[model samples]
Target: MESLRELFKIGFGPSSSHTMGPQRAASKIKEQYPNASRFEVELYGSLALTGKGHLTDYIIKQTLGKQTIVRFKSDRLPYHPNGMKFYVYQDEEILDTITAYSIGGGTVEYEGSKLQQTKQIYPHKNLKEIIQYIEDNGISFYDYVLNYEDEHFKAYLFEVLDSMFTCVQNGLHHEGVIPGRLQLKRVAKSMYQQAINTRRESDRERLLVSSYAYAVSEENACGNKIVTAPTCGASGILPAVLFYCYKQLEIPRKELIKALAVAGLFGNVIKHNATISGADGGCQAEVGSACAMAAAAYGWILELNNSLIEYAAEMGLEHNLGLTCDPVGGYVQIPCIERNGFGALRAIDAASYAKQLGYLRKNKVSFDSIVNVMKETGKDLNSAYKETSLGGLAKEFGLKDGD
Candidate 1:
């Protein structure tokens, strides 16, 4: 597995795959051909289907300049759903062509063996191996991460956490309709206000967590800056849980940072073993993985054992299986934002369940097994449900109101 730095990318959202990945690819191509007069990009499959709503073309143009031509092709490349072919031009002559795959979480892989391998930080690639390593070393999961990661990782995580907190704060302060045809009203401020006024402690806690989640998700949907917890689409879940622990439960900042490390370790395992791209694995890969990451982090905050933490992570993904990437109108609104709120609640519930029941019964299905299942399920999902926006909620209601 690579460093947590790759897993948690800080960038302007709405999408990591559609926006961040393509933007990165375009920037790289432009740098490689600095003398090129113009650029042409052809988006394929999921990228083409939802590119307009996700601002894929907008970012590419922003990166490659106004002369860049962006085309949408429904057919997919053999490599990935979020695939693109770039053509560099100088004086109306094609200089070179490059094909790249946005393999989720803002990670891009170029064709023809162009991707350079980063040093693998962790020897263990799956949850079972990770747990065994921790058990043998008599260390916590975060310690296992620290054993492989450089000392600079602590400062990096502090920056990531700071970015997350800033996004949440910014969202809570901004109040207006989100920038989309849907005109979705920003609900985070209202929700946070309601959370502050709620009489029931339990309800207040739930509202606070959900408001934080919504705050981040809303910010992402508005093309605001946010950290990808696993992906931009699912960015809200982990921060929601961790922020709740920090503010409501009064967990120390150092402890919360440790929890972030633990969460990143689990997220790395999932990314290594399965897929975190919604276009590749449906919403399960994005939101489900984020939920699992948050659950594991919450379990760590509660000081649960490895078995219980794994249980919490497993339940988080298991319940979210078959969740489709059905963002209505190809925009990361509607189900996307609401799903983050629910995913946050579910993460907390999963950790609480593991805390209460993990001792009575061992988890039959491991987190590793669930990741495998998730990968297989993502493969089984139809292309329409895999962020193409051809089916599911996107298709059914996409043109009904003409948003």
Candidate 2:
């Protein structure tokens, strides 16, 4: 794992892989050819298929300006699912041609660059192995993260948490129809208002979390700034759960910071062991991972022991296994925004269930095992189901290739 920084990227959303990643790639091009007269980029596979709705082209143009030429290459690349080739020209002649892959989140890999070393922050890469180390060290999982992370990590996490809440506040205040053909009415503000007025005490926490999740997801869909708890596609889950716990359960800010650390560690584990990009692993890797992260965080907040905390995280991912990346209309709207609400609700419920069951004591399955299974299942999934928008809800809604 690189750092919690890699796991939580603060950027313009809707789609992290499609928007943030491409913007980063274009930024590198601008730096390399500062005086170039022309720039061209050909988006491939998942990028090409859903780039329009994700604002991939708009982002690139915004980064590189009007001199840029863009193309949609629908054919899948051999290197990665979300691939783009960049061409820079000093005049009419091509100066350089480079290809890059937006692996996941906001990370990008250049074809000619040396491969990124999978640096191990801790000795263990999975939850099963780390739990034993935790048992021996007399330390919590968050302590394990602290042992390896920089001393300034506390400040970094504070910033991340700050950004999360800011997005929620902004999303809650903004009310209008979201962009794109769907004209999806902004429901977060209304949802929040309803939750506030509800007399059903049992529904208060659930509704609050659901509204918060919707707020964050709606912000992302509107191209507003938000933190990618794992990725922009699933940005809403962690904040919704954590904020709910802080407000409803009255957890202290310092304790919530520890919870954030725990969640980041879990996210890093998944990103290292499998994939977090829908272009590679579908929605299972994106929102599914976010749910697990939120679950573990909430479990920590609830004062669950290590075993149950892991169990909560396990249930979060297990139930969401094989969830496909089926954002309707290629826009991270319809199912994507609604999906975050469900992810938040499930995460909170999973934590409570694990605590009640004492799942760590008798559960047969392990979080590490599920991580492996998720990767295998993602590999087995068809390309169309992995953010290409060529199948599932996209196809059912009559969205064609490159739509």
Candidate 3:
């Protein structure tokens, strides 16, 4: 809780695990050897397994080219198998050739002769030993690092949540209209149109109705290009609640921070007790847990009651108990893109329903029990369904082949 590692991370992605993690790892290596002339990056384990489809290779190239993961655009980055390699220069002197990988969930590792370690092995790679190195050497680190002040941390969380809301609102407005290599689905487009028509309604009302629209139209919603929530694949839930509170409810920024604080609490609980990486626990841990977090946050805002917030989160977690993270062609396209809407809608519903019921009744279900159920469900799930693009909609349907 004091570290804020789980709540905040930096890196590239079509996925937090596959894309962002690798880029973060490479960036850490660059920080380690500011004066090094050359570097090489490599991937191992799960990163290498679905690295290509997840854009792990592309993310590494951008990291090495002196590009921060948070700013690189997926479309502009190179996508070859050896991935992209960058030769850097400082003051007309040739530097190093840097290589890296997108190891999912914003974790990265360095693979080169110049470096002593090949893997970025910290539990939260963004806060790895390299950050310690910077601190030890009295060098400036990235602005995103936590300063550990309650008020300051709260301010940072609110700012990130506000930015997330803005990004989603903008993304939904133009997710499909401005097309990209990834084809747009008609569902999101239709829902966006419907939302436009219903703008005059209360923000909460608009969100409740539009959540369903976006969920049904998952193929079309655009993810946050760089400054986005975890990933487009699980983006909508966090934004929907925040936007609703901001617009319809007229909730203050401080209140929004409270909601997000609650969210971080619940999210960390899951990350510590179960898993968030798709490779480990599948989509349930990602979108499902995110939905649960959002639901809990919304409940916190609505009920002004802690138990109610916990209940709402547990309900959200329980509902998505068996969800999987199977993406077609291993890319975060297909069902992956649309899944965010569903997760968001589910979170909204859970919050609303919990508000109608008393907290005591809701708490009988228990968050711990729900988490256990999720872990069990994940264990029961087929490996093909675990973001491998080998089963579920990725296989039973023609999504993999078509992609």
Candidate 4:
């Protein structure tokens, strides 16, 4: 039941769990050993498997200095899949050693006392508790968050929304191959231009939204500063949907901010009950959570009732269950970039469907239950499918190094 700090992290990232987390950890370790002669960082599990492509070493080097040594440990950690060990050396003597885990959604946990960093702002953690509170108090989730979280959180959210918009703008204009072996061309500009020139009205919204999602996600892939809707890998979904809501649906800026609050609440529930890391729960945790967060926000913007909002959120994750995190060549391009467009589309569809089915009690599944199932399913998945790029499309494509 930690605060929703992970919901909207503004950082440069090709991968949050891989790049941002390690850089953050390195910065922390640097603070502890400012005068150390040298530093070495060991990346474990998924972080190591994809560190080269995700620029984990590059970011760590930037934080610790050019001479910083980075070693990749393919062996999985007992604590979390994305683990890093930082060491400081002076005159051939070990000054300090630190270990940390990037537990999805840009959250880093130190070797010990990780729990000490978390604070529960809301008394309620799960959907059921919040639902009960809503039923009793007759106030919406929006009200609940406003009542519980202080003004600072709201101000932070405004900044987050502004940053999201700025990211989309930056992505749309930037073109050329992202720095990597794949040499993938930026598509947001072309997509946006194509959408604008579309002769058919039916495809306008879809095209534009996909372009927006592509913009943010492609920016993430290039290690540009972007907000992690849940995480950087799936950052595009929420922004795409929100932008569409603002431009197409004409939702006001004030209402859109409120919608963001509701979305953060939904994401916080999943982060508490399940997770939001591809390394932990495959792509289902990352993209699925983003899809659900977007759907919930859309539902709230539509003024749908609480049950319908939950239903929208649940469908988003349910439909994406078991989706593997198999980034091609360990880079967050390929399936990852296109995946954000699909996730955003699914989120929009899920929200519309939930709104259409409002008050119909024919559902057999619940949002809270789906969160549990997602975590269990993630735990049951093979390591290769969980962001190691060893299985699924990552393997079958036979482009291990994209060589």
Q: Which candidate tops lDDT? A: 1
- Model 3, position 27, has a per-residue lDDT of 68
Task: For each of the candidates, give the backbone clash count.
Answer: 0, 0, 21, 0
| Tens digits of lDDT, candidate 2, 1-403 | 6788878888898888999999988988788778999899999999998989898988999999898888998597797899999888888898888889898888888887433433556667788788898899899988888888889998888888889989988988999999888788999999999998999987876788999999999999989999988999999999998888778888877788899999999988898899999999999999999999999999998889998998999999999999999777789986898899999999989999999898446778889999999999999999889998878899888865324
Distance from true position, residue 89, model 4, in Å? 2.6
The residue ranges of model 3 lying beyond 4 angstroms of the native Cα positions read 10-12, 35-40, 65-151, 175-182, 185-190, 196-223, 226-232, 359-362, 397-403
lDDT of each: 0.91, 0.88, 0.57, 0.88
Cand. 3 TM to true fold: 0.71
Whose TM-score is greatest here? 1
| Local accuracy of candidate 1 as per-residue lDDT tens digits, 126-163 | 88888887888788887888888898989898999989
* Off by more than 4 A, model 2: 114-123, 359-361, 400-403
Relative to the true structure, candidate 4 reaches a TM of 0.96
lDDT of 2 at 276: 93
Cα RMSD, model 1:
1.5
Candidate 4, lDDT over the whole model: 0.88
Of 2 and 3, the candidate ahead on lDDT is 2
Q: Which stretches of candidate 1 lie over 4 Å from their true place?
A: 113-119, 400-403
Instruction: List CA RMSD, all candidates.
Output: 1.5, 1.9, 9.2, 1.7
lDDT tens digits, residues 69-154, model 4?
A: 99988697799999888777996999777788999877888876332355677888799999999889988887888887777887
